[model samples]
Structures are given as C-alpha cells and as structure tokens.
Target: MTHNPDFKDGAAYIGGEFVPIGEAKISVLDWGFTRSDAVYDVVHVKDGRFFRLDDHLARFERSMARRRIELAEDRQALKDILVRCVQLAGLTDSYVAMVASRGRPRVKGSRKPSDCANHLVAYAIPWIDVIPLEVQERGAKLLISDHPRVADEAVDPTVKNYQWSDLTSGLFDANDEGFDTAVLCDGRGMVTEGPGFNVFAVIGGGLVTPERGCLHGITRQSVIDICGKEGIVCRAGDLPRADLETAEEVFLCTTAGGIMPIAQVGERVIEAGAPGPVTRRVMASYTAMHEDAAYVTFVDTPTRFAAAE
Candidate 1:
C-alpha cells in the first residue's frame, strides 16, 4: 500500500493515537472483529462539511440501543470524534466512518475483571470521486439475488452492525451473476434494498422509496425531502421487482454514493438510459445544502507566519 504522506487505508485511530494500519490491532478473539459483532455509521463530507450529522447520530444511537452495546462516549463525544477524525486526516473532501463494536465478552483487554462487552473504532479516509451520470448515458445494472436480505429477527434492520456476511454474500452472488449490485428481497419474496443502500423508484413522476423496516437510509430521507421541496409527490413504501420495469426513474442513495441512477433491470431499460431530470435536480439541491452546513464556516490564517518560517 502506498502510504501517502498523509493517507493510509488500514491506518486508523484507537486509544487517541494515529498508528500504522498494520500496527493498530484488534484481537482475533475479540467479539467485535472475530464474530463481526458491532455497529458503524458513516458521514459524508462535501465542501468540508458533514451532511446530516445530527440525523446520523440519531440513527447511531438507535443502532447502539438495538444490540445493547454500552459506550462511554455519548452524543457530544461522538460529535467530537467525528471532528477529530476529519482534522487528523487533513481532508477537506472525503467520507469519514465512526464504528463502535461490542467489546470482547471474555475480559481479554480490560483490567476490569467484570468484562468488556464493547469497543469504539473511528477513522477517516479520502473517498474516490463519486461518479456522476452523463446525460443519456446508460447507468449501472443490478441482478436479483436468490438470497434474501438478513432476517429482521436475526438482526434489527436499523442497526449498522458488523454482522454483514449475509450482505457481502449477496453482493458476491450478484457479481457472480454478472451484475453491479445485489437486489435483496425479504422472506415474503418482496424486494427490500440493494445490500447497503436504499431502493427507490419514480413511478409516474412521484418519488417512491421503501419504508425502513429493513434498511433505514439517511440519504433516502434526504432525497424524499428534496422531492418535497421541488414540488414532486413522494412516497415511502415497498417496491417490488415487478414494479422496476414499469418505473420512470430508479436510483440508489448512500453517504459515500450520492444518487445513482439505474439504467436497466434484466432486459428492460428505465425511462432513459441515464439520470432523469428529477434525479439531477435532487443531486444539485443536495449539493447546495452541503454548502450551507456548519463546517463551511470561514477559515483565516496569520498573514505573517510564512515570513517567520
């Protein structure tokens, strides 16, 4: 790995220090890493600001409560961690991830004889530029996976837990099927979402996204909010595989990935080969909102510092 003067992939923060990716370690026996026992949240940075931090934190708290992973750092602490990570990376454009996992239950790394059931891991990385759609260009394709999404009973849909072998498996299944992503269904054979992102469709100029009992996407809510602002009718409900072919526009949303347009499903094409007018408008509007966020506050430096150096 090219350890740029500043960035490293496996490099991360733990116990308040920046360490080499190889040196910073977790246990083979730790519940978090070993069994994928944990939760995580990601915040997107555009023009040096985190989009919907409060909303992300709210969902994060919900994730924590879902698995009962106790943490010493609460909301304010989370906010501080987010800022510190961004500052450490010295990145003005990129995505930052804040992850908290259930600590090893066997009392391996802690002095407290009682037991440590959770741990917190946080880091930041400069993200690759998001691919934007060119007008009339065909969007990526998706394949329907025979495997369904993780059951709601095995894990609550809201928590961004680390137990994602099932999700990854779905992606692999899709790749093997020669598609870009995996469209997962519920036990009822109803389409839920693309492994990590929310599923959305445009049916007759109305914005339709799935309601979250399976995946609660912050970006999905942003899109819905943008639709409301632009005077487009919007709905959040179940969308089936059958509805995809007839839809006017279809897209996926996530923190790192902005709105992504889907060009085709199976042998059928969406309304156009590329992004529609509505998707373009929402993406533009969301960009404007990012500009007005708190982190965009003015920056100033001492004028004479360079002369002293």
Candidate 2:
C-alpha cells in the first residue's frame, strides 16, 4: 500500500479503518462492486468549510433508506468520520463523499437482501469541478441524447444510485457527436436531466427545470433559493425538448460545480451561443454564497491547529 506524498490529494476510510485512498479495498464478492448496489453523496468543501453539509447528509440518509441499506454509524458518527477524513487530508478545499453499500452475502448462494451486511465508506480528496472553469466561462455544448433515462418506476430517480448504464451510453453518444455533455429525455420527449446534473432553461423570460426523473440536487435547491431571493421567476415542471431547443438560455446544476451555463443544444444556438444574462446572475449569486457565513459548516480546524499553538 502506498500513501501519496501530498495528504490533500487522497485519503479514505474503508470499512472500519482509515487508509490512504490508493490502499482502500473492497472484496470482489461485495454487492456494491459486483452489482453496483450502492448509494452515495458528495459534498463540497471550500476554505475548510462544507457547503450545505446538513442538506447533503439529509439527502444521503433518504437515499440509504430508499435502498434498504443501513450502516452501523448514525448521522453524527458519520459526520465525524467525514470531518476526520478531511482533517487527515489537510485540505482547505475538497470533495468528500459518503457511501453505503450492500456487503457480501453471508449464506454463499443466498439471493436475499437480508443475507448481507451493509457498510459505510467515506473519502476526502481535492475539490473537483465537473464543468471546468474555462468550459464554464465559454459555456458547455449539450447533445440532446438519443438514449432516454431509465423509467423512474424501475429505479427511482430521486434516490442516488450507481445505475448509470443509460447515462453512460448517452454521454458516449454526446462525445461521438462532438459535444461537451448530454441531457436525457423521458419516453415522451420531455427533458429529464443530464448525466450528473439537473437541467434548467430560460424559456420566454422565465426559468424552468424538469420536475421529475432527476436527482433532487442540493445545488439545484440552492439555485431555486437564489432564484427566490433574486426574484428570477424559477419553476419546476415538465420541460419538453422543444422548449429546451428554443430556450433563450440553459444551465446545469450539481454539487461539483454550482451552476454551469449551456451555450448550445446540439446545433441550436442559445443567446448567440454564449452564457446569458440570467445564467451569469445565478452563477455569481451561487458563487458568492460559498463565502457567506450562513451557508458554511466549518470543519474542526482548531484541533488541527492545536499542536502548532
């Protein structure tokens, strides 16, 4: 096992032990690895503070409950592990994730869910932005995916899971078409979401996003809150492909990057294929919130600084 020289690069808590991320391991028999039976959430830390920490934790708990997987650690205990993981990494800005997975089945060939134990895995690594800063500034180009989202009846979209086959295919389609990313639609041609982000559009001078068939992102909620504060007139409802194609502006929201503007959908140009006024406004507002004391959940920095004092 090798520990990376820079602590801020990689650190993880596997099973009941803390280890270098490169050293962390899961058994081949684990359901999470074999069948992709896992639920996880990522929370962003900026300047030693977690943004919307409680909201992320609450959504994670809901995802776990929906999957019928429970870890031995309670909310407070899990939060402590996350904080310690960040401390171990010595990262002022990081991307941290909490995962709960179905473990190896105990009865050898048993197919029952109860035959396995569930476990928690947490990690802290340097911050990541899904849409790079340069890309965001220039704005992203999205391919309206030919592949559709998996029916919500089969797998609830609200529960964060590892069922990404459909999304993966769509992303490949986007790449083949020479686009930045993809946005999926439902069977009826209603826009559902993108691979890792929620879709939003500025239609007829109003902001709208799909009401169903997408993960209820914490950052999406933050955008809505910002809209309410700024009086931007945002709403959630069915957004058709036609509306998206003809919209004045579009953007994606996720924890990795708060708000990313979209300049084109396939061959359609929006706001002259540039980040629009409303999109820029929301992005600015979301960015400013990270530095606001009200939105930050600070990590245990005092303990780390104690030895220095």
Candidate 3:
C-alpha cells in the first residue's frame, strides 16, 4: 500500500479498512461513543520499533475480557493493524492506540449491553508526552486535586475504560491553578493517579505507589522492574496524601511520557525543584530499555509480519 499525504499526520483502522485518521468515524449511537462503553490500550513506537508490544497487547486483551467486549480480530490481527497504522502514517516515533468499543445495539432502544456488538478501532499518530518535554526537564508541578477518583468497584481501574469525568475535572482544576497536571485521591486521603499517569513517591529511602484506585500502568511496572534490578526498595500499598506530601522525591509514569520527575506537589517543593537522584537513574534506565531487544518489536521487519500471518 502506498502512503497518502493525508495520512502523514495520522492513520486509522476501522471496519476492516485503513483510512486517514481524520476520515475514521464511528456511529454516534455506538455505545462506545454515547455511553463511553469502550476499553483501549496504547503502545508507543519509538525509533521504528514498538516498545513492549506483547505486554500492551496482553493488557488490552485483559481489558476487553473484563468489559465483555469481543472483536473478531485476534491478537495477531490486532498487532498487524496497529503496525499498518504506523506504517501508513510513516511515523518513526508514534503513539498508537487500539480500542474495543461496544457498538450500537442491534435492537434499537435496547439497554442491554449484551445486545450490542463489539468492534476494534485503531490509530497511530505523532508521539505525545503527557507532560511536555520542557516541563519534564525542570520536573512537573502537580496539584493535589479536590476531585476524587471514582471507586474501583464502580468502574474497574484495571480495565482501561473511557470513564474520565473525575480525572478531567481534576486536570481542569490543576490547569486553572497554574499547575502542569493533577493527581486524584481516593476521597479517603489515599493518593490515586493523575489523568494519564501513575503516581510514585520516594520516602524514607523506599519507593511506594498507591496499590489501589489507579490503572496498573505499563510504565509503572517498568519502574518497579528497574527498582528491583537496581536494588532500590519498591513496594505498592496505601500511599496517603500526607505521606506523598512529605516525600523526598516524587514522579509520574506513563506510556506517553515514560518517567517524569515531579518538582512540586501543591505548594511543597520536592528535591529542591529538580529531578532527584533516584528519579534520574530510573529515567535513564527507562530510556535505555527502549533499545533492548527483549522489550521491543521492530516495526519494519517483514519477519514479524510473516510470523503474525
């Protein structure tokens, strides 16, 4: 397939065909659109290779299973589609997303979720940073938002769904207050996560992140692995807002931005407004892993396509 100039910015897959990202569309009635009944996952392609492709796909599958959304494409088909999107977009570094949406109910006006068909929609666009590069350089300023995260019971945090009212509201609050981003708590005063990233804190010489009320982010796992390999103590459990406030260092992790150090949380400054020693070490390790064969899937390799076939 020849590359289209319209797709130079982005490309998408929908209904078994590829199109320019702008041309991609879904029915307004699709539950995924109207009711936000969808589960999605993102995997970054850097330097023409996909980072932790298998892990991202596995998580995507798990999310779909949890939401009871099934599409006709299997794992291999999904991978091929995602690769094609990046190829069509001609992007060396791209942010790729695979989504499973609960389509409009076959029987009009049916409220039953089981009556709706499910399908996959995917796209690849330019690489994105949840926190801009310049902000990451000096470290981000965050707000402890007043809006609390939706309880895990109401909407499973483990499943990557489109339920973001609380997160978006918090982000608005942060921006309005002149902060770069925001993190929501569990109402009980336990820190949860930011809009698109997981929170981490270094306190008393150990690393701790909230074990609940947050998405189990791939980058968060990478940080945990890096800590283990580097012999730094890391644990996941209740991370109270007060404890986070007193942390010697703080950071956020996500697929889009990797490891981002925090310079300040609310009015308190961390590590004198800079990326701390441990945060810098982990960031370096995360960057290095992008080149590791064990963690990457090259995008242009015909062998990968053949294997998927």
Which one wins on lDDT? 3
Ranking 2 against 3 by lDDT, winner:
3
As a whole number from 0 to 100, the lDDT of residue 290 in candidate 1 is 72
lDDT of 2 by residue, 1-309 (tens): 244344546678887767777777899999999999999999999889999888889999999999999899888777777887888888888999999999989899988888988999999998899878898888899999989899899999999988999999999998898999999999989999888899989987779999888998999999999999998999999999999999999999999877888988889878645668888889889989998888888877444223332
Residues 81-162, model 1: lDDT tens digits: 6666565565676677777776666654664423765777777677642333442245867666777777778777778866
Which residue window of length 10 is worst by lDDT in model 3? 300-309
Model 3: C-alpha RMSD to truth? 2.2
lDDT of 3 by residue, 104-221 (tens): 8989899999999899999999999999999999889999998989999898998988899999999999989999999999969999998999998998878999889999999999
Model 1, which residues run further than 4 Å from truth? 1-11, 20-22, 106-114, 128-138, 294-309
lDDT of 3: 0.91
lDDT of each: 0.68, 0.87, 0.91
RMSD of every candidate to native, in Å, equals 5.1, 2.6, 2.2
Highest TM-score against the true fold, candidate? 3
